[model samples]
Target chain A: MAMKIGEGKFKENVNKNMEDTFMRGAVAGAQERLRTRRLDAAEELGNWEEWRSHGEEIRKHVLDNLDYYLHELAENLQKRGGHVFFAETADEATGYIREVVNANGGKKILKAKSMVTEEISLNQVLEQEGCKVIETDLGEYILQLDEHDPPSHIVAPALHKNKEQIRDVFSDKLDYKMTSKPEELALHARETLRQEFLTADIGITGCNFAIAESGSVGLVTNEGNAGLVSDLPKTQIAVMGMERIVPTFEEFEVLVGLLTRSAVGQKLTSYITALTGPREEGDADGPEEFHLVIVDNGRSKILGTEFQSVLQCIRCAACINVCPVYRHIGGHSYNSIYPGPIGAVLTPLLGGYDDFKDLPYASTLCAACTDACPVKIPLHELLHKHRQVIVEREGRAPISEKLAMKAFGLGAASNPMYAAGSKMAAAMMKPFTKNDRISSGPGPLKAWTEIREFPAPNKERFRDWFKQHEKGGGEQ
Target chain B: MKVTLFITCIVDMFQADVGKATVEVLERLGCDIKFPMGQVCCGQPAYNSGYVEESKDAMKKMITTFENAEIIVTPSGSCATMFKEYQRIFHNDPVWRPRAERLAVKTYELTEFIVHVLGVENIGAKLNGVATYHPSCHMTRLLGVKDAPMTLLQNVEGLRFEPLPNAHNCCGFGGTFSVKMGNISEQMVDEKVDSAEQTGADFLIGADGGCLMNIGGRIERRGKPIRVMHIAEVLNSR
Candidate 1:
């Protein structure tokens, strides 16, 4: 429910984000860096396409047998003394967590950049119940300090913010005096969060991939905050989307390998901690109680549907990084924690077509996202499918567009109708034509010519000229 | 070699020069070119805009239009991609699926047809200009024709080909999207023009009409002094 962020129509958000030069500049720069790094990392791996295929195979296999893996994961975790809670809805997931918090008198909670927790609005729920939740990841910590500005991207949440903005946020919120240098800002945040990491009663995190064989949850992060989150607190909660499970550590290794390289171009992040159950017998360091909450807010329904491939996503934002639309509009335009190409496809499925219908059409169907997907999600196809549903099944398309398309279908299917239309185009457009182009005109030309000049309809159609050339003995 | 031309709706109505050039280039390559008068739109605009069922009629019409050709060629990579996509579009229809498949295999973008089918690397065309090429999204990524245009472009005797910076990015001409999301498309196309400008190429050469129209239109509107040429026209240049 909380997956949808900000308060506006998609267009309104896009218009606002387009106007944010600071954010646009930051997004464009990050996209280039991340894109280059990802490509370099993929190339260094040698046979990246093969690796992508292997990754896709593992994800597809796991998704196909998700129920079996989920059951195995839960039973194995239970055997290892880990409490497993399967929540069917966002409300149920948060309600169970709130109960867990109240039972343990868990007032201070430190979270380690969990997107599922954000999806469930866990922080606001716990905050209302008097729990002071602190975000430990640097980007997340910055956003938390900035009075909970919703995350624009999944992996790099604060990618929309520049260092100057971070410094401003830190100064305004934390009463810190510091320059906009990244090192200084990071050190300030680390100093601020170290106390919370030690003192918080509960630690929360999102699972990168859960292993069904050993019932271990893998958390990948460069910040080492996830390690601290899973190890420091007495009560540890790992919330995962139901589809984030693999058959074993072997599959886990394959996916996590793709995740890191595709995500931030790291061979192995500073932290790739895999935790199974609570603290075991004679364990040197671990949580006293570990809870794995498997959430299926909308995933189970999509399992057998045409959209099942979407659940194979590892949440690496490589698709976001290469998306030209995402580059222009930035992440916030999506109005979801999951922004960019993946977000455009996944958000509508998780959220419905009502508010999210526009998300599918937001894409140019460029297929960059599909090519960049480590698991080969066919993101552009999925986006097109959403449009099909909107126009064909949902009947949500506008009356004008529907009528226009109806006419298009008639004209396009019949050659005589088309020939007539093309023959009539020049004469009909003559009033609007000047200097061989329609710079500005009426109807559809109005939207197009606003930004670019459209060529006036050719007075002599190509087929007509071809016939003339044919009769003139192939002469130019 | 015989080639039936699916001169797409845009080329037939708007950029007739591209169509004319395609015919000339193919004819020079010893191809007996046939322009099917029955061919119309590729159903991409309606199909991409999400009218799958409504677009099928146009698709079927196209399939039948080019059913008897030895090979199908088009100036636009995007429309060729749409032609290739027809097989999948009619996947569930027993009657049309095979018919669509027959059309899909024989279809080729003009440059692809010139370089691959005709087995000719260059047309020996000469044009005096520094130029850059925009690999339109559907042409490069969807149809998977990455090398043919560049192969042909690299051979043009008098042209200096500078690689477009961030050239792989979409020029934001997603049919109705150009109008539907004009604000965002404006930013995207502007960046594309900026990249093409950065190439210091007087001529911005491209393979797809949709993309060229979008980028070329923007260039012309902004009076950026960059001339946009379709690869067919570029190949036909002397």
Candidate 2:
């Protein structure tokens, strides 16, 4: 229920995830499907890079003047007869949302897929007040039925589970006997959820993007459940991260295009719903009382810092899809609701390094995430920045690593130390060297040797070889 | 064309044969090779781990060492990418940033140097074996040397190139990441080796020594019968 999901060392989590062949198969299959779909969509879109740049520019512009846009958004929403609350912390945000439900005499809230609500833990707060909460999104419904299982991915909440697992969850909770086919499961979930939506007093949804100029919230979904959640219930509440707003519809269009393509490789999502305030006098099926909660939590602190570029993220998960680390470990290993490259950088900042110190080092610095990112977040570099903070600022890096790095710093920066280190390298590794390869190595080499052979230090260093060749004029 | 070889520290001490092959291959392709002895390391190992202060000394050493060379070339893509990274590292220092840019402008990975700079696609090399190339992340993405290695290898006589499954994935040889997060690194390398085996290639060829060493070491330990060779070694072979 806390921010950390798979809380432990990254290696232990990875080992645990790797052992779960079922989960691995599910993750790898999803990644392959999503990766190809994303690539094909981008190729079809044509000038995907230009669109990405435009999206990045719009996000940067919005973030640069976030205060102005937030005010403009609040003003426009207030004009349209909607209540707006800015919560600076998670406690405040959840507290405000609970009060809204209490004032409305709400019980049995029907919720659409919303990451921000999960991030702020809003459902638990409402449930503690003794309200029945039902998740309407198909993936979310399965996870909610399975004793509120944590979402592994942003787009696919139950990404770690295959249809068989979903069927088991549905069979046990819903007591339905059916095949593990997706359509069968989806139909069963829809039948079960339809009744909940009809009786629910309130609906909660996360805003994909908020239009500041018109005070409209945009929701992009494949299932169209979000539209039902927002419109069916008499009382509706939308929760959004403060950075999720756009200045105008033009900027919103660019971002939605980039988001749909980058996230699941769709030119356009099946449903793109934009709702403004509440239903008017002439309106046909919609919520009457609407409230918008813009939660800052820890985002404001990152506004002007070096990490501001991270805010440009559209939650596309292209970075996550291509990440080598995420490919093997799946999302839970990251120990946060958010995982992969973005999570590695974002989690530690939001939750602090004490709980997620290892997240930064979880990457191989492969820059695969950096390349895959549509908005050009430089995710790998941001991850490195976390390491810098952990080491130089927080001083939380393992003492052994710090000591080793210190020695490396002294040895690497100076010519004499490097020369001496390179000279004595062959002898130092002699005990481990066999047939010119160190099959079993020592110290740092131990980890490498666990799976692969470590090449022994050459008898004659390249410096020596180069010097000899130079003196002898180039012949081997 | 005269090319100065920045034999990365790994190639300098651990994989000297790779450096030798690189020199031979470049020379065979009509390059006059110059070994810059003062070039000890590219400072990447420290720089990447956020030891900027520590890495600066090596960066300065390299800038001075290869300052006079007509064109700087290296056997490692990761290391060559490090040359491209120098400007960013010295962004605050006006004097060093320009010098770093100059180094980056002239630097290339061995295959890139041979194919792009020298305009030599075929070097008359013969290796009668099916090989799959692992395009290291730094080389293909960061350094943007994607097609040069493939272009050169396509012209190699008697060599059958197989496509590596999941070739775009990292080999889990993230320099210190191999040892720092050894458990994760082990799993990643295992998967990489598995993918290479699926290719049915006799050998795994790569541009960077770091990747080759990782994949090669795993192949050796598992006794997979798949030989791992650097691009230079593959290109130099006849």
Give the winner by TM-score. 1
Q: What's candidate 2's DockQ score? A: 0.75
- Stretches of candidate 2 exceeding 4 Å from the true structure: A473-475
- In model 2, the number of clashes is 1
Alpha-carbon runs more than 4 Å astray in model 1: A473-475
RMSD (Å) of each candidate, 1 decimal: 1.1, 1.3
Compose the digit string of candidate 2's lDDT tens values, residues A1-476. 55677547766877888788888778878888888998898889898788778877888998999999999999999999999999999999999889989999998898888888888888889899999988888888888899988888888878888888889998899998999999999999888888887888999999999999999999999988999899899999999999999998888888888889889988899999998999999998889999999999899999999999999888989888888888888899988988999999999888888788888888988998888788889999999888777777877767787787778777776778888999998899998888988877667777778778888888888777777776776447
The alpha-carbon lDDT assigned to residue A247 of candidate 1 equals: 89
DockQ, per-model, please? 0.90, 0.75
Tell me, by lDDT, which candidate is best.
Answer: 1
TM-scores, each model vs. reference = 0.99, 0.98
Candidate 2 retains true contacts at a fraction of 0.74
Task: State the displacement of the C-alpha of residue A466, model 2, in Å, after optimal TM-score superposition.
Answer: 2.5
